[model samples]
Target: KAAYNKYLSDKRAKSTRAYIISQGIDPKRIESAIGYGEERLLNGCDGSIKCTSAQHQLNRRSEFIIVDM
Candidate 1:
């Protein structure tokens, strides 16, 4: 399950990055897609805790940070 989660996270990040570039955003301006792979949880949903599918879905996400203007 862990491996699959990481795989999904990576795939989603890659797709999102590609999408941003497809929208005409400068490729150089965009940072490489980084997947935390369950390292951070938005709703504290983790393997130890039983959460609804909806709650677990929250952890599958991507964050875009602007390092330079």
Candidate 2:
């Protein structure tokens, strides 16, 4: 699970960052592409327990968290 989680996270983060850049987000303003993997869950989904597919799907996601630099 850890390996797969990392793989997906890396893939998602890279593609997302690239897309953002291609869309004209200033490169200097961009910080870094961060892959959190399965570390942070937005909902109640865990590998140790059973969860609906929808719940698990929510865990596999990415977001751009901007902060003042």
Candidate 3:
């Protein structure tokens, strides 16, 4: 989970920084964004836990926020 979170965080931060720069925001003026991954599961464990790990992982995701600089 930690590794996944780190990976997603890096991904989101890079993407956000690129977008901000592309929109004419100064690179140095912008701070980094953070990604929250898989921590907020929407579906409560419905029925059996027999679903494949890959299925559960599909729920795992990345989220991002822009730092106010």
> Which candidate achieves the best lDDT against the true structure?
1
Kindly report which residue stretches of model 2 are placed more than 4 angstroms away from their true locations once superposed: none
Pitting candidate 1 against candidate 3, the one with the higher TM-score is 1
Write down the worst ten-residue block by lDDT for model 1. 31-40
lDDT of 1 by residue, 1-69 (tens): 877777888899999999999999899998689776777779878788889999988888888999987
Per-model C-alpha lDDT, please? 0.84, 0.82, 0.61
Model 2 poorest ten-residue lDDT run:
60-69
Give the winner by TM-score: 1
Model 3 ranges with Cα > 4 A deviation: 33-69
| Candidate 2 deviation (Cα RMSD) | 1.9
- TM-score of each candidate structure, all chains considered together: 0.84, 0.81, 0.44
Ranking by lDDT: 1, 2, 3
Question: Can you write out model 2's per-residue Cα lDDT over 18-55, one digit (the tens) per residue?
Answer: 98889998888778877777778787676878899999
Candidate 2 lDDT score at position 11: 89
- TM-score of model number 2: 0.81
Clashes of 2: 0
Give all candidate RMSDs, comma-separated: 1.4, 1.9, 5.6
